[model samples]
Target: MRRPDVALVAWGLLGTVAASLALAVAGQLPFGLVVLDVGIALAIAAPIALRLLGVVIPDVLVTATLLAAAGGVVVAHTALAARLAPRDLPLLHFAAALVIALVFMPGQAWLRAATNRLVLRRSRHQQAALQAFLHTLSPELGTLECCRRALAELVRVRQVPGAAIILRDGEAIAHGDFDLAPLVHVWPRGAAADALPARSFGTIELRALPLALREALVRAHVTLGAGPILSPRRRWGHLFLNTGMLGGFFHEDDVEGFQAFVAQLALLLDGADLLARTVAVERSLAHAEKLAALGELAARIAHEIRNPVTAARSLAQQLSREPGLPWVAEHRLILEELERVERRVGELLRFARRDELRFEPVDLGELARATLDALRPRLDAAGIAAGLEASPGVVARADRDKLRQVLVNLLENARDALATSPSPRRVTVAVRNGEGVATLSVTDNGPGAPAEVLSRLFEPFFSTKQTGTGLGLAIARHAVEAHGGAIVAAPAEGAGLAFRVTLPLAETP
Candidate 1:
């Protein structure tokens, strides 16, 4: 028997002996009747009283104590009765033996089995409920959806007003009436592994917690039962319950259920994260394949159009050179239009063909300044104010000519965007060096493209401008990517568009 059970038996025996002695001293009732009353009361009422006091005593211990008390009572009664009437001793002995054999032994076993079934029935129901909840969590559900469903089920099972799931990165999903912001701030990264118990389920009483967390919980109007969602690799987040109204307590079965739920939730979160990444990679691969096929087709078509376009331009130029030709002005216009077509074909070919890069240490600040200087005449003509912001020694390993062309394209793109803007139309080019990379950006104070347009900005033949051939940005992207760099366009702060280029910094000797 456990220590508590042994103590309880000892105390119970002492109390029974004392009660019998008091009844004998009073001389109001027979000792046999007194013992019988005491034994029956203890057998029937002890379990009920202990349960009312929230003490969980095993039914086997109760049965054993009752049997020991009854045997003592029978022995004491038989000794006293034999002195009074020796003739009836055999009858008394036989009756006592018959009762012990036919009733007490078999009754104890049946009583133990019956009590156990009654006690464990609730626990079995709880386990079944938990299992059904787990089954509802399908693999296809996303992280937020999982959290929402889990919180809903927790509130239902635990009968709490609120619940929350706060991930390690500070993303939170909350359900019910409670405020979770304070809780989130206090347990943003969840409990540390070393701080948590082995089972990872713990109660958080307002008084027992640290002052700051306690105050935060008080402000949020909740006491907490929290479990870490952890795996062998890492802790994903925490699951929290509002247990203040529950007197900051959880049943043993509830704790076990909580631990199981969080363990499975961690695995589900991992699977969801992996699935999202897999989908993104698949999309990226598909887009790359599509772009490659489009580039190949564009190259073939450009090759077929280039020779005929060159011949037409040459013939138009020859016709314009004849001094006596009628409609000379019209002939000049034809030559100009053909030349424009030739330029577009050349841009298409550049965008389609991948050229071998000649990489060298190129000062990005200097390159920006030179590109701006070359475009100064056009900027003056367009009434657009252009300025450059550069940090010293911000250099990158790149093909100088190709990199120069990229800057020229971006600046011209910005200049064109600013053409219709109101007074003080401006373009700013900035260069700065960061960890292992150099960044250059050209920003314009002009109407920026919407998100839908921005997404297709670098695609060949995708343009918003009426007169655009749409190959400039596409070619710029190819050249920048060849040098192990990236280019992106976004709406600049306040107004207009910003195009940023990032390149790997040149290594220093």
Candidate 2:
């Protein structure tokens, strides 16, 4: 199979041809010439024929035997045809060898091809299977099923007894022999790695990979193999085959064949990963587009609503100032209510419009006290006790109005939460000054937010309150981030919720 030992075949052919020609030339031999001719033909074809029958003989010996028989046939036939004398033998022998090589080499080649098909029947079968699965395997339902089918295809292609597909997410399926579990991501630590033999095929160390990969290889029983599942960017997974399934370990040709199949699987996984990311990006872009549209609509509505709101507030103020008005107190209440509506409308506009930050250094300690005073009436009405713990000279560089708005929203949320809190319905505003940062933590005695709702708290249109527009925390988060700060909400110790706002400390003046 390496290369035909042409010299050996020529010698064998020469000996057979010479022996037969000698008997023919002697002319006194019996009717044995015809019998020897048939024997010579079988002998010429036997070495190649033996290989086709799956008989393993030394390559050199088989080549020599086959070539010699072909040479014998040529010499015998030439001698019979020419019937030359012994002294003229040198030229005739040379002519016989050349004629055999030229005339029969083509036939030999065709015969060799025919025998090769027989010798490599399994390889041909594998090619057929790979071609079949090329169009059959698809990534649908899930990766697990698709990969499992791929494993089955490999089993067919390799003619292996069994195989397995172990997914990254912990699902495992087999070609027949493995009973995969619901999950097998966690590899056994320590001695449990010994279940599989310590051997490698390509770059895949079955034992060193994951547990699922190791288990699948050991079950197959072949270690000296090629099972590398590779990609240009990452390791998707691997493939393995049984060495003793139908025969022994995979031949050199088998190794070359599997490379293509494994590559296709790796490409599939890479494409799937890319597709998922693209879908996620598409969803995010659509969500952002919707948000942008809503922002424009909200901006227009706020501008239109502000006109009537301002006029109503001014009209109420003018009427309250009139002398001897019968409903002076009622008019005063209407003016106060109008002012509250105007303030609410202002918050709506601030939230809807993306205004650039008007950054200035502000004393957060003083601001916290002022915010509590402004909301003093609401606190009194709710029967909530308020307190402030401020570090001296706690200051931050931020947009004053926007930063105050974030604090007010946090405080208002806390106040509303504490409305039903027992006994000491308390709200604490604490400001801490540290190296290059200021942290404002607002805590209240109220039922804390659930763990499930904490993550989406800052997502626009997500809310817990019945009448809430759900923009408060979202707007607060936006404002804080605009000033290069961060806001986090979490359950407070024991009872209630806490909002921590951290901002960059202002340069000391």
Candidate 3:
């Protein structure tokens, strides 16, 4: 609710007195009727003030008060007329009051409407300034300093006594002189009684804004129309303001400007979110690149150091085979460990190489069959069967040896998974040509890779197996990527591991 403007009050009072005098003369009443007419005009003005101020001053109370006051004026005029024998004394008194009513209706309505419009225009100007302020909050320019600056500018431009931005996380932070947390936490959640059709009214306790501030607002004629700040994920706070004194209530335009201002702020917030995510992604990439370089260096060092160790161990094993060696078993054990180290070194070197591939048009079906045949001894030892279903002539341009290595890795993983699992232990290699692309999948009946490892499965030297170099899938990924293809691990429906590899077929010359 707002206080009435002094100018409007004065204008209504002045007009009421002058118009009441004219009506008195027209009805031929005596000059003494002027004071009576002025009194009646003041009575009418009070009720109109109460209505504009959003008070529930009942119509019956206004009518009863006016009728009782009018009755007294009538009785006095009738007594005076009886003494002087004046014509139409009762009619003249009634006419004066009617004139007051007629004059007050249009005058009061125009004043209220004009004041509301002025307030809306003032609010709109403030909103435009706030929109410009929000643009400065972009993180690309760096820091929350811009947001702080925007906050300050908002306070100054809006002439807001105080302003604050309270994050939904319950951070009670102030911007300029405004302390938002207290206001936000205690702000009304439901509808307002004086709710205008155009804008939502935020709850305002009369004590929160002083009469001086209210008077200044009415004097400045600031109007605000606003809505609650709400988000699907969280409760966003609202954009609202109290207009000091020049008050009639807000019109449609003020609400529109407020809603638009908040919408722009939301966009700025979204941009900040995107900028933060981009920074995170770049940091992740940098970290991944660093780790890849370190892995390559470690792999190279292993290859460089293993050859000499392997040669020395082979010599030791050969010498130990002679009858004179008392610790032959220990020497043999050393040789076996050295052999394992050599194998690991070879795996590392394979992972480290990033040389240009020697591309050739090769049949994926034939390549997969050959890989399976080579791993037949291991399959037999594990007591696992193999199923090969391939699309004929599914050719792609890639390094045949590298593709075969990828298939071998896939087969080895499938065989290992089968050995560890109960029930059926079988691996499937299926190749298909559809949707203008070729695909090959190796599936097995074993537990699927853990969700935690799935994202990092292609990373070098990350493995779950005790005796694994952890570079098998990583090398396989590198090989497929080199040929403009993709390989992915998925759970097999029936039982074990399933690896899907997709490749683009070569275009005909």
On TM-score, the leading prediction is: 1
Give the Cα-based TM-score of candidate 3 against the true structure.
0.49
Q: How displaced is residue 277 in candidate 2, in Å?
A: 2.7
Q: Pick the candidate with the highest lDDT.
A: 1
TM-score of each: 0.70, 0.50, 0.49
Clashes of 1: 0
Q: Which stretches of candidate 2 lie over 4 Å from their true place?
A: 1-124, 127-229, 237-259, 318-336, 357-464, 476-509
RMSD of each: 12.4, 16.2, 17.4
1-509, model 1: which lDDT tens digit per residue?
22333456567767776777777778845874678577756744553354333323334455665678578758876776868677887777777777776546776766544543444222345556755786778757877887788788776765566778777777888888667778777764544523544454343333444677666656565544467788766777777766432224345655676788788777877777788889889998998888788888888888899899888888888887887899987987888888888788788778777889999999999999988999999998899988999999998999999999999899889888988888788899999998779999999999999999999999878888999988899999989999999999999999999999999999899
**Clash pairs, model 2 backbone:** 9-67, 9-68, 12-68, 13-68, 13-71, 13-72, 17-72
Q: Write the per-residue lDDT of candidate 2 for residues 1-509, one digit (tens) a residue.
A: 11232444555677767777777778835544774676577656754554333323223334665678687777686766578777787877787677677645675555544444443335456665775775565544345566777777776655555566544333456675433342244433233433433323532443456665555444344343434455685554445554331233334565566676677777776666776777789998997788778778777887898899899888888887888888888898888877776666676777778988888899999999999899978987888888999999888998888888888898888877887778789899999987678999999979888898988898876888875767888889988988898999898998888899999999875
As for model 3, its CA RMSD to the true structure in angstroms is: 17.4
lDDT at position 128, candidate 3 = 66
After aligning candidate 3 to the native by TM-score, how far in Å is the CA of 338 from where it should be?
Answer: 3.1
Give each model's whole-structure lDDT: 0.76, 0.68, 0.64
Supply candidate 1's per-residue lDDT for 30.
89
lDDT score at residue 209, model 3, on the 0-100 scale: 48
The C-alpha stretches of model 3 lying farther than 4 A from their native spots are: 1-277, 316-336, 434-437
